[model samples]
Target chain A: MNLPPLVQGFVLHFGEMGSRWGLNRTLGQMYALLYVSPQPLNADEITEKLGISRSNVSMGLRELQAWRLVRLEHHPGDRREYFSAPQDVWAIFRTLAEERQRREIEPTLSMLRDALLETVETDEEKHAQARMGEMQALMEQLTTWFTEMNRLSPETLTRLMAMGSRVAKLLELKDRLRTRSG
Target chain B: MNLPPLVQGFVLHFGEMGSRWGLNRTLGQMYALLYVSPQPLNADEITEKLGISRSNVSMGLRELQAWRLVRLEHHPGDRREYFSAPQDVWAIFRTLAEERQRREIEPTLSMLRDALLETVETDEEKHAQARMGEMQALMEQLTTWFTEMNRLSPETLTRLMAMGSRVAKLLELKDRLRTRSG
Candidate 1:
């Protein structure tokens, strides 16, 4: 692979981190390449730059598209499909969060709910159900919070995040005001 | 493996879901077993219940301890160490977040910082650096927010989460009040 040294370094590092992020090495490297490139890259360019097989690039692009991490574009008068990472980083982050919730968190929550519905035949079942209940409650709360936050415009979300835990001060103020009014 | 049916079902599900959470199947199953069991369990018990080899259970337990997901204890007269998941689900969630930040997020941020420090010889390098800067800024903001939240007592954290995006309304109110005061 004859990528620029900087891009090469990041691609390799991302590939290594891929498993931790629930992606395989090729997908990570492909995404990293697209992410850092100045222009949308076709599968042929990707294969040549990354020294990967055509089929592998095809597969990786497919998976990335499935995750909503990559977008397909067509160049003027060029029919070959090109892939590019989302231009906005926050949009990329939001896509990842949404996809992971749909693929992993939502299914796990559903499984817990199903388990909770089953009849308990013994003390062991009761204890297991209780554990599932705790986990389900935690998951529901987090998912609810994410769902609410996801509805906000990106600008609003950024402001809210920038506020950070300073929002706690607001909460404290609200509580004090309520106490005085009551 | 003679696990109770309900416990077994959850353990198997966790094992399947483990890779998505950056854990192997064995680690997920072992943690699941400990989480659902009413009492602390020793390695032998885990091995028998999960039908994994003794060595696999030992390795899994060692890794789980490293992740701070399991606590080790000793019985009054028994030499074998017993392991249990933290009783509070929030505590488990916190440990997982802290560990992931340390292992994955922090290192990625550091890598981005290092990349940003490099001299750019070409437009490609310059563009890549800009992208890296954007990502670094976003990550810094997120880590800062998490650090601030982590400082709050768990009780306060719970309250903030329970408040969810209602906090956004508070942000709006604060903005309105600031406009009047200014």
Candidate 2:
């Protein structure tokens, strides 16, 4: 494995983080390796670097590509595919959020909406429907919000994440306005 | 089982999303039941509601407590322990993000730091160290960003996620300014 000591350390760290963010430890580690790699890495190279089974590397790469965390690079005169992460951090952020919304949030929202179509037979059912409606609306709003953000430039995402302390006050005021308007 | 149809739907849906969000399917469904419930539920109650084994509820509730996702509640003269999720969406978000950070990110960072302290003995080791440093730095920054976000009100989170369209641009500008200033 061509693992660098310091870089390898970070790669290991990301691998662990992968599980927390809806990925496995190996997936996290693989992305870390790709993220810092200046050159596009083929699956064989990645398998060699991490010293894991080639099949495991293949599965991990598929997951990363699904997350839009890795890109395939086709080099001339070689049938082997090389991979790399987005150099622009903002693009990575957009793709991650977009993919998550599609994969995780959208299906659940659809299910929630389907539940809404059912007839209520009792007070308990009525109450459940009310709560479901609230959550469904919230999901719809959140989904639309992400869709909008997916369209943003990296600069916007950074500024927004660092919106600083005013964020709290802004939220309170926004809620108040939402209440009044409602 | 006081299973309302819509609530049951929510329970089943959450069960499916559980693995995607770190929790397993049963845990997800169990939490969904707790979230919509007006009163605290004992393990038997949860088991009944979801048609699962009482023992499974016991284990699932234990995991929820560890994640800080479920709260322990008691009633006077009640011997059985009760569990429920925070009804406030923001509180739930805080627990999820914070618990994940502690479990996944912190340990990996520690590992990377230790590896970075080692002396490089070969060209390969040197490259590893360089990669580790970059990853460590990225995790640190991302961690800082999440830490800051954790402090925001749920309304702020909703608003921020709603501001998805602007986040990328905000991030891009932040990166440019950072480059200019650095």
Candidate 3:
């Protein structure tokens, strides 16, 4: 409710980014404010800073919790709930990845598995089936990869980012091999 | 219009995934189906298969076309417009990176730049400005990184996917550093 213009702009920007991320305007702004603040924030602080209704902040907090983007906090002397994001960016990233996988990836995968069972009646159907099989396999492998990636030690992930410069040439070389020989 | 159950499931999953990727459900599904299929799809084919109105498919196709995810094809004697995804996974991925930068990142960056100009007087405003400055710098860099990443040839992009296994670890390690030191 009392955010500075700069912070307000930050909130407004995230509000816009929210729709792109399958969230709404206010949701985006609320999370942006939460994420950037150095200290943990309570609902009342959030409501006062954001100038939204108390109920809206409450609902938004619920959604953010579901996304694993926000963690609840308790102060020794205070009865009101406070929330914060993991200070470690990697932890936040992993939580987001896992949440998206659970909320989006796993269910779609199950549906694909079920669809794989439908009987085919025509050559077109069979061809479609074949193509579907390829994508389904791809999705399954991607899921497996995410599972492993999420479980990987933090040090290992850091090494991976450091290796980005090397990967460009390695992949380009592999592409040439597949193109020329295959 | 006919897709194998497995492909159907994955395509539908992608459709669902699409919203998360900044597309609506119908557009997501349409692109998913197109992405995995061997043949180009017509609007009517998409409408009939997805059980959406023809107009919706028409609009979705237009949006996909704008995103560069769909390309028009003229089959010698065929008058109807048909569309297909880029044949290579890397190409499709590149389109995604580039298109999203254009549609979402670039505009937001501009907005942030403008907001950065507003003069600050209070301590809270200064605090907000400091945070906004940090985020804006990181976002500008990220946008730059995506642009540079897209400029890499498809061969380079595929190789980068292989690098995915390493990125998680590197990012995690960075988080540790920031935690102990920052």
Q: What is the lDDT ranking, best to worst?
A: 1, 2, 3
TM-score for candidate 3, residues paired by index: 0.76
- iRMS of each prediction in angstroms? 1.2, 4.2, 5.0
Cα lDDT tens digits, model 3, A1-182, are 57766777778878878887677877887788877687889998988888899999999999988888889989999999999865555676577668867876677667767766888786766766665566566567566666766776666644543454554644455557579999
TM-score winner between candidates 2 and 3: 2
Q: Give me the runs in candidate 3 sitting further than 4 Å from their true place.
A: A114-121, A140-163, A169-182, B1-18, B36-38, B110-121, B133-182
The 0-to-1 C-alpha lDDT of every candidate, in the order given, reads 0.89, 0.77, 0.72
Of the two candidates 1 and 2, the one with more favorable lDDT, higher being better, is 1
Quote fnat for model 2. Answer: 0.49
- Per-residue C-alpha lDDT of model 3 across residues B20-87, encoded as one tens digit per residue: 76788888888887876668989888888788899999999999899898899988898999999876
Docking class of 2: acceptable
Evaluation by DockQ, superior candidate among 1 and 3? 1
Listed in order, each prediction's TM-score against the native is: 0.97, 0.79, 0.76
Task: Point out the higher-scoring one by TM-score: 1 or 3.
Answer: 1
Interface RMSD of 2: 4.2
What C-alpha lDDT, on a 0 to 100 scale, does residue B16 get in candidate 3? 70
Off by over 4 Å in 2: A167-182, B1-4, B109-142, B149-182
Docking class for model 1 is: medium
Return the DockQ of model 1.
0.74
